[model samples]
Target chain A: MSAPLIELVDIEKHFGPVIALNGVSVSVKEGECHCLLGDNGAGKSTFIKTMSGVHKPTRGTIRVQGAEVTFNSPRDAMEAGIATVYQDLAMIPLMSVTRNFWMGREPEKRFGPFKMFDFHTANKVTLSEMAKMGIHLRSPDQAVGTLSGGERQTVAIARAVYFGAKVLILDEPTSALGVRQTSNVLATIDKVRKKGIGVVFITHNVRHAMAVGDRFTVLNRGKTLGTAARGEIKAEELQDMMAGGQELAALEGSLGGTI
Target chain B: MAEANQAAAPIKDERVREMSPLRKALIRPELGAICGTIVVFLFFLAIARDSGMFAPEGIINWGTVAAQFAIIAVGACLLMIAGEFDLSVGSMIGFSGIVIALMTVQWGFPAWFGILVAFALALAIGALNGFLVIRTGLPSFIVTLAFLYILRGLTIFISITTTRKTIIGGVREASEGDPIAWLFGGKVFNGLFVWLADLGIVDTFVAGPKAGQPVVEGIPMLMIWALALIVFGHLLLTRTKFGNWIFASGGDAQAARYVGVPVNRVKISMFMFSAFCATVFATCQVMEFGSAAADRGLLKEFEAIISVVIGGALLTGGYGSVIGAALGALIFGVVQQGLFFAGVESSLFRVFLGVILLLAVILNTYIRRMITGER
Candidate 1:
């Protein structure tokens, strides 16, 4: 419908002699969820890392808003409005939610000649932003470790959204979550997609991907199998593709079809 | 099902469950240190009250000693919170004092210049310590332990080579009128003490050339430096963005790096701060003693670490308080001096350090469990 907000064309990544991602391509349009489905060792991590600028692809053209760009570091990608909420979440457990929310870009207030972190602004922003994601915080001073797994996810997602991320990359946001937490995260994804922000939801779970993904791209052993629009793919078909069609069929036969 | 209701009305905010205030306070990093300080003060007051331990002059004695520990403990606390250690701190103190003495007394340099040189050299070594750890990906404990021996050997060798002895004197003469030296060695609030002595509010010398002057002269610059460092360290850790970075760097270094925090720089800077603190302590010691000895500050690094641990800092890092560390130092100074005042064996102070450190570690482990919610 509209020009892709960000595009990765023919991306290739190599770790010395081993090729991690081989000529994989994916793109995200505005307000669209592009799900990248891959099983273990499918290079999903390498692809996302390249997209988020943690690793420089050996071959690829990255276009952001129709302009060819290169990111040398995660900071560069963030400056280009690409924020990645990694699997580990990159949050300090012992720190307060407010502190972790404003970790890198802390707001400062000046008193005469001295400057200090503006806790008032930070606390207020943290509480409201978290609430917007349906997480009511008792105190911004509470340690992040005290929050449930689901609430921590909301904090991370809300943080990326609040920081003006045009493209949000979620690395298995639902992988560690229970069913209820996973649904909450899905709802958060729905909210983000509605706000005109492009989302790259990376996961191996076909059902979770099908829940919010508008376009699905299946990555098999560092190469894209195919891209399908919402109605073009079914859950069973995607799950079969994710498990590697023939290989899984062969394993099923060897295991006497118990699987 | 329930998720739909949660999305619709935020029912009761189950996620933000309330805990009792006492349960909350129990998890704080400073709770153990605060309680320890109170217990120590009460114990000393009960036994040493009639022994002049609470007298102003006697208070100054322990207070100055506490300040010494606090100065180094502040640096150690911050460094430990940043997830590193500096075993070289004691050697750095000895080396710094020797450098100042060698430069000012033997080489006939100005006291201010010598102090600057000592600080510069110690910081460089400190930076080197951080660099080696970062580059080698080794634990800071090992890197700094190596530096401990290197710096101690260098200090002794240099002093012996230059002056044929491991001790240097004439620092007081060389630094007599220097303003920078006075900042470390001189007393403050002299006029206030004088006025108080004149008004009979403070005790005065009864029979000496200094009769009518306050027996407690004024607050030593060492104590002021200690207090300043404690306040500065506390504020920097709690009220600044850099403080957050420090906590993140130690808490989860890889996570911090992924989040765009400069973990290497934060850690390296902490090592340098530790060296800076040791140098300050050394300068004050040399100035106060009017000499520098290569054997000075022996085992002081362990003392500083013990103070931080007693203050409730986790050995694994990412959690601590500077005020807590200062209070831990206060407990040390009081117990060390109070032992003598209460007619106990002074050597029992070492026994006290071992006992208190163990007790603090156990208490900290419990608090950590409370915060982390681990069994």
Candidate 2:
């Protein structure tokens, strides 16, 4: 209630002739799991990009830690304690897990014009950080590609939190995961939320959103339907809102006609 | 800061064999190249049948030529790991040799000065190649292909204009008394060869009346440079943050950028490093050959790329080792020289090379997929 960790007021995003997001507003509070629920092509990606400084809002204000701030790049957002773990995770499949965890920010030790990567620190940090996320890697030297989908997602999440993320944005982290893997990712989210970091879990699955989400924001066609707390909103109503209120009826009618 | 609350139950039912130490070593990208080296060496040894090809002399014979290809191949491997290509390397060899020849032979500049000038010019060209590729977002293949022609033509035009002949000679004589040329060209230690000669290790000096004089000479300096480059390349690729950046940039440039890697800078440096190596080869070659021709170093770029590919680097980018490239060069040299030792036709060498490349690539791809658990 006392100024959320990150607040977006009437956020709008556009790409030339396309309006991907319009007057959408959402805020994530400290130590809360706020799910951004939207279907495919519902501008979830564009919205997160805006939040993570990948894109500037066409019209709206973004407040972080109670201050209006503008982000020029992803680095800017990261510096301002916002980290995004995209679905792809942005990890090198061939590289070791430690390498991927510290991709852009590798530790280095220098001696007389010769600088070397500090594998000792990297491996130590990677193993411990991943363990803290409820996912213990066998070895830091193991390739990230070898890890399961849920584990990879957890690695990304852990890396974000390790690198200082007051607000974490996960873009469809469980979309491609299997049932067990999905639950594993949910467990990771729960662990992260307990650490007092604000989480923006982007997903389209109603059950997944309802599982750990403390607050839900439903978006469709570049607009937000509404935001509701877990106790306030009914599961049936949230499902209808995600389907665009009447979009599902229209789809059902079309299928009925074909039948 | 919280401890892992690992689930009590095992999740995966699939049978994944516990990886062993030996299995880990076998999956290394360089494994194929190492095996290929041994196979090729043994094949040559069997065919040579009591020839010196089994001895250090044979190693020297094949190694000298391998060194030439290895120098350039190391650069190709690095650039490939960084997810790019520079087809202009072969032409860069010609260009650098010509520039150095002109400056030292025609302009009478000190050989060291000429070498420095050529180095700077090569780095500049490399930087330009990188700039164009990065800024325009064009495939390096197309960009470097254009440079290949541009540099080749420039070399020819310059060669014809400066000297009446396309070939420039007397570089060795021109470089006489210049310490830099001597450092690059002159051999340091004669004791090992002298000892070998005394022990009847190598053939008695084959030519001239003085040839019977137990004529052990200093080692070829280019071989030293080649060996040095191997150690340097291996360390840089494995021990440095720059190496990690190269792999990251090559693996997925977009993803690397998303995580805040300086992908553009990494790529551009790789291009420059590739060209710089070509120039280094030229410097050593001109010092060794005593001459430079506009037509020098034709098709060397393909040879370098082939070596890198044989070393188990993916053409698509990312995931490679320079030590693998070194061994790949070794495989090439052994097979090539072994043919000569066995009295086989040289043209068949191309067929053998083609087969080896195909086999090596398939093996590397299969191994990588197995390791990554990708289909």
Candidate 3:
């Protein structure tokens, strides 16, 4: 097969003497949805931060487009077309929609030594990109804090795609969302995938991962359990693995019911 | 594809709610400031009808006072938007003024060179303030509060050792014959004021030092600086990439860092900018008044923040405008002069201040709720 868009081989991260991520290998191909599933304290955050270049791996190699790459900062990773939409979506709620859409990477036109942000281009692109995700905002001037959780996630996703991100990492985008909002975010992810971008979906919900994920890499503690292609693993099986099956059964034997 | 496409179907839904232009205008936070200004003006006019509060002299009178707080408020507005505070701003004005005085007035250097030295010092101290907050992770309120006293004490000591007096006088003479001094210190559009006075539209407000001469020149340089800054500050806060960084860093520092905004640098620059404005105010004070007192600019920090808050900025951060803050300063000026013109107790303006601040905040909340469409 063609080389995956990005690959992490046996990545390990350490904080002091404690190991956070131990030899976890994962990869995502172009247009593929690779869901990284783990429960609380499963080191999912560490893995993504490493991938997004916020933290350096103590061991192993990260490859972008089949070439070995070492990222010293998040900007380096972003320049390589990797964008992370953090749980907060990296958005300013009180700012206008267009401003938040182009916060860090704003478009500008120069007038001599004086440079001015190109509000026209920013506003137009923000509206059109948001429309592609089925969100028709009334005005790009509205504050983002007024948007619903679902719409805000869509804005983040649209922003990532608009900025030429080939690898999009969504870290728990739907964690704080309601049922409808989760569905909305899943839909936005699917639209992003069709745009030929690779996605790293991080969540603990088995049903969510099954619904949108093409490949699943289950993590427990700091280690990866295994990888499963679509339909290779059942939803209940994934849930059991996440719940630590053997330990949960022993606790169930003692309590005899849900605690 | 099927599920995601389901959400994309009918992408152009009429469900995208649109607000009318009038409703949009009504929801602006500055709307409160605008209305308050008009109400205060009408109230003052009713009480001080014969007083010069509305005429050219009254305007120039209150305007210069408003300029002092307004200039500082602009700095406070930007700093507040970036999620930081500088209680040392008032002290900065005094300390920098003393630095200017000791350099030029006491030591006999050109005013321009002394002003330049003061600028360098103010920016350096501002950088130190930003560094201490960023490196040590202390709240800016505490950091700057400490500098407030430190600078005040430093100004006093510098004055005592250099000139053997707490007030450094004769700055106007020290600035004389320097071309650059005109940029920051003196009045402009003198012919306009003279013409208006000749037409009897404006009174010959003050006697010039010479006989039969009206010293009441055109608008004070302080007023001109305040207006110019209002324009420049608004554009810098609204129309530049740097402005976006300021909003993002203040809005969510972690998120801004993740997005490569260099949040620390954005905040640090804002500290320096605040110092720059304070330095400007101090320079004007020194040039116009021809002296610097150690006790100059006392309680000006609270006044500036109050102006910003009255302008509808949250003390916590991430939302505000310079125009709003400027208008807030104007409100302060009108109430101050209105009470003075009416011959009422000067302290009664404090009562007016409390009422105005409360009303502005309440109105701001109401407008925000309406804009957000909350029930």
Ranking by DockQ: 2, 3, 1
Task: For model 2, give the RMSD to the true fold.
Answer: 2.9
Output the lDDT of residue B174, model 2: 96
DockQ for every model comes to: 0.39, 0.52, 0.47
Native contacts retained by candidate 2: 0.60
Ranking by TM-score, best first? 1, 3, 2
Interface RMSD score of candidate 3: 4.9
lDDT (Cα atoms) of all candidates against the true structure: 0.89, 0.87, 0.87
lDDT (C-alpha) at residue A203 in model 2: 94
* Predicted structure 2: clash tally: 0
Model 1: per-residue Cα lDDT over A164-227, one tens digit each: 9999999998999899999999999999999999999999888899899999999999999889
Candidate 3 regions with alpha-carbon error over 4 angstroms: A111-113, A249-259, B1-17, B205-215, B370-375
Ranking of all predicted structures according to lDDT, beginning with the best and ending with the worst: 1, 3, 2
lDDT of 2 by residue, B1-375 (tens): 233223222233345456788888788888778778877877876779677677666777788889888999998999998899999999999999999999999999999999999999999999999999999999999999999999999999999987987899999999998988876687757777777777887556678876753443666777787788888888887888888889998989988998888999998888988998899889888998899989888999999999999998988888888988988888888788888888899998999989888888888888878766556
- Candidate 2 lDDT, A65-88, residue by residue in tens: 899999999999999999999898
Query: Could you tell me the lDDT of residue B88 within candidate 3?
Result: 96
Clashing pairs in 1: none
Q: Which candidate wins on DockQ?
A: 2
Colliding pairs, model 2: none
